[model samples]
Target: MSPFAMRRRHAFAAGLALPFARTAFAQGDYPSRPVTVVIGFTPAGLTDTMTRIIAGRMGRELGQNLVVENRPGAATSIASAHVAQARADGYTLLMGTASLAINPALQPSLPPRDPRQDLAPVGMAYESPFLLIVRADLPIRDLADFVAHARAHPGRIEMGSSGTGATNHLLIAMLAREAGIQLEHIPYRGAAAALTDLRGGRIAATWATPPDAMPLVGDGTARALAVSSRERMRTLPDVPAAPETLPGVHGTFWQGLFAPPGTPEPVLARLGAALDAATRDPEIVRRAEESGVVMRPGDGGALRAYLASETERWSTLIRAANIRAE
Candidate 1:
């Protein structure tokens, strides 16, 4: 064949293989390298602890390591912003918690980036209810009795929280609203201080996660009266669900896996699948349950929906309570 004819034949052959090549590249071994999971809290914190648990199994399922990186500050707004600004390549992700949804409404200084818009929810990891803990000597025994006492006492009783706009604060505010009473909510720099006060009989109550409250309850330092979940927590089955006495009060320290915005659908699907599988793993469930967490495994869309509902729910209470960051 002539030179031009030979060139045309080669070009045609290349074109024929181009589509297959593109397909292969698109479907290439995703996550050929390690993926980093970012948490907005310090190590050993609730968010970090759960992310560490689920990310390991997810890494195994994805055939790559899932590294847990801590960037705790500004009530997780800093780490959340970091993940929100990261490249949309599935390699960077956030083990986002309820704080991500709650912070925008709570922190006036936090430049607004709707988590629903800025980050891609990969999947739900797990959720843990806040236990309403009081000093063991307090007459409050269960949620109903607590509500009645708060109603009778009004602003006289003190309710403590981690911070002014924290989930614990929002939960207590919601409880106050539901009971038609006023609680003198005292905000602290950390749960430890609030818990310490509760143990010392300085504060009436504080909303605490299982990790923070269960130990105190176990040692008779505090009494768990109720859990802020719609239903009973399997780990704290003896405690009544707050919603039983006050309907629609389901506040939890829920967490979801997230990626930066614009991450491709296929990458998200893979991560979500691995997450769903790993979160449901029997050992993962057992570990999380042992820590008083309820394993919730779902897809990105479900996570998005959950975030939306949580944001609305928490924001309304924060506004109603006039909650602002300390």
Candidate 2:
């Protein structure tokens, strides 16, 4: 070929590659500014605390502070929608809770921006076990006693949760079906409120994460009847697992990192790596262990699969109970 022709062809190829090259560079230099991690609930809730702890480590690793913003409302739909509509850049992310998966099932009419489609899971932060805690003075001493009392009282037993269609609410609905007991479900603005009612003796029971419930239960303010996991919590060895007490009853709350759905794959990878490293941080691990949080460090694909299965699991029960986020 002639020299002039070769030069022209090379220029044409470079022109074609320019846009792709720019995108690659942008992804590589992600989070040139502070990244925001949005939480759907108030500060100090299980999800909020876990995200704060991990974001600290992740910020140090990425050389850019990960700022956590709480946008709690409408059962996390507010935060999920905020993140869903944000730029697809890695700068904005959601400290996604299991409620993201269950919200749609609970509030179908609320038009939740479908986290599975609107956000991309970066990686799991940690999984927390919820305990079925009752007012310490309730006429129940164990799961058996609680079950009998609930059966006897039927709709009189008021079981409170963070909110309608929340994990605890749905788990109680599932329990109603499995145990053939009637529970009058009470949903609060947040777990803190519901637990407050429980402690005040205004409510019969509530589902609280170990981190939030540990202090209250330890202080004799509440009694943990059974944990939601199949295995008992090491710290709460006296409490039996729900599945053992009542077959097929299980639920857990997990937190993950998520970005706008259209985020670049390379950016997602970079953030995922940061999250993986943060989850393994020694201090983070120690704090999580003390709070009964199980370290999963699950990646994007694992989180996606978990969302799929959890959605299906909770949807079935929600539909069965005709539960919604009213």
Candidate 3:
């Protein structure tokens, strides 16, 4: 090629790279202003609480406030969609829950029908398991007894959950399928209401989060039979893992951070680093464990892999059980 032609070709290549260079430069100063982290559930819930803790620390790390705004509705679809549709700039983010995966599988009509495509994962925040608790007065003293009773009285066991298609509800379905028992699921507007009824003996059994279950378990208002995780909870060491009684039955309520799709890689790296550091913070870890949450902090790849596995796992269960959103 002629010298002039080569010079022109080099200029064209450089022009093509300019846009990318600009993006990197902008991302280098990510969060030039406050960053907003949207949550799908109301304040005070596990998701909200954890997000605030982690976001506060992350904000300090990033030198900008991470504001948490709740837009709870449609089982978290509203908040999720808002972030998913926002600009790919690092300013807007979502503190997504397991509902991110569940809503798509259970309610196909909801916005963000594909979490993997709509959101770019920053990192995993934390995870907590549901506690399988029964009425304190029941003869069920352990998971073995609960399973035997459930099997013996199949459809008679009244299992309460937060709501139909909720994570706990799906855990109920998983338990039934794995243990070959039938549970008459009683869906409440929220887990708090369900636990209230469980305490009142209105429901025979229900799954509750650790923070919710610990008080009742300690006070003898309810009996904890098993934990939904594959392993025992650190605080409740005596509560056997559900998988011990019914293998392959594991469930967790987890949260992760996400930026809108197409976010620049540099911005993601910065956010991921902040999140990883926050999760490793001693106070953050202590508070999380004390509240029955385990900090698993990981990078975008970890969150991506987790989201894919969870989506597939729950999608299969929802389809097999014909779960539908209310």
Candidate 4:
């Protein structure tokens, strides 16, 4: 071939590859700016705290700031919707919770772009069991006593939850169904307020996350009846699992990170790697343990599988209990 002809052919090939090279580079240099993690619950809650901790470590790992935005309302559907509509870049993320799975089952009329359908799991951060607590003055002492009391005084025992359709509320309903007992449910704006009412004896019991329940139980204001986990909590070993008496009942709330669907696979993998590292960090693990969260890290595929199982489990409970958004 002539040298001039060969040079012309090489130039054509290079020209064709420029756009593809740019696209690949763009993916490789993701998060050139800050990343925003949208949390579905209110600030200062367990989810917010966990997200901020993970975000700080993740920011350090990525050498970019990770901003946590709280959009707490509508049973967490508001924040989730925001992420679902966000650009499918790594910039937008969701601090997904057990509510991510429960919301679809509880609120069937939510919208076409549900979080379960619109968001993709990036990684899981931690898991924790909710504690069934009652005011110290309450006569009930254990799961069996609580059920007996509820059965003896149908509609008289009032239980409180952060809100309707929340994981706490759904778990309570599940316990009720499985125990063959009936209790009045009181929905509060948040878990803090519900705890206040329970302390005041206005409510008989509440399903509280361990962090929230631990302080109350420690102060002698409330008694933790049982943990809603398959195994006992390390910090509260004396307290038995709720399933001990109820037999086949078990539940826990999980917190994790998610991205809008269509996020590049490379970015997702990078985020997952950062999360796995964060979960294993000594400080992060210690802080989570102190906060009553079990540090459990899983990659994108494992997180997705866990979410699918949780969705199915909650769906069955919701249908069986005829639970719907209030």
Candidate 2 deviant stretches above 4 angstroms: 1-18, 21-23, 109-112
lDDT of 3 by residue, 1-326 (tens): 43323433454466456797546546576778999999998888778888999999999999999999999998888998888777666889999999988887888778787888778899999999999988888889988888799888879989999999988999999988887889998999888899898888899989889889878888999888899988898878988998887787898999999987766677889999999999999999999988999898899999999999999999999999888877
Best by lDDT: 3
CA lDDT of 73 in candidate 4? 74
Selected candidate, larger TM-score, 1 vs 2: 1
Residue-by-residue lDDT tens digits, candidate 4, 210-277: 88898889999898999998888887899999888887678888888888666666788888888899
lDDT of each: 0.82, 0.80, 0.87, 0.82
List clash counts for every candidate, in order. 0, 0, 0, 0
Q: Candidate 4: lDDT over CA atoms? A: 0.82
- Taking the tens digit of each residue's C-alpha lDDT, what string does model 1 give over 1-326? 43323433454466456666435426956888999998888898767778888988998899999999998887788887787777666899989888878887887456325777777789998888889888888788887878788778779889899887778888878887878888998999989999889888899889998888888899998889888888998767788888787786768888899887666667888899999998899998998888888999899999999999888878888888787776
For every candidate in turn, the CA RMSD to the true structure comes to 8.8, 7.8, 6.7, 8.6
Q: What's the residue-level lDDT of 279 in candidate 3? A: 90
**Stretches of model 4 off by over 4 angstroms after superposition:** 1-27
> Worst lDDT window (10 residues) for model 4?
1-10
Residue pairs with backbone overlap in model 2: none
User: Which TM-score value belongs to model 2?
Assistant: 0.85
lDDT score for residue 175 of model 2: 81
Q: After superposing candidate 1, which stretches have Cα over 4 Å from the reference?
A: 1-25, 108-112
